[model samples]
Target: MLATAQALIGRKVDIVTSSKILAIRDASNDPNEG
Candidate 1:
């Protein structure tokens, strides 16, 4: 049960990190926003 919980948390972290990276990329791509 502990391992499963760890895996779930890890997946959520990965998703959040990915979305953050995409947001940064999008901001960089738009000159008006920067």
Candidate 2:
């Protein structure tokens, strides 16, 4: 996903890859969240 983001923006991205992931919420289908 990080690679994709960098590709879209055409720049290096700074992210906390070592940190523990807290939550991943998928609200794609929900209109309110989207």
Best by lDDT: 1
> What lDDT tens digits, residue by residue, belong to model 2 across residues 1-34?
8777887898965443443442233334454742
Best TM-score among the predictions, by candidate number: 1
Candidate 1 lDDT, 1-34, residue by residue in tens = 6656878777532223458778888778976953
Q: What is the lDDT of residue 23 in candidate 1?
A: 80
How high a TM-score does candidate 2 get? 0.29
Worst 10 residues of 1 by lDDT: 9-18
Candidate 2: give the clashing pairs: none
What's model 2's overall lDDT? 0.53
Instruction: Mark the regions of model 1 whose C-alpha exceeds 4 Å error after superposition.
Output: 1-18
Off-target runs (Cα >4 Å) in candidate 2 are: 12-34
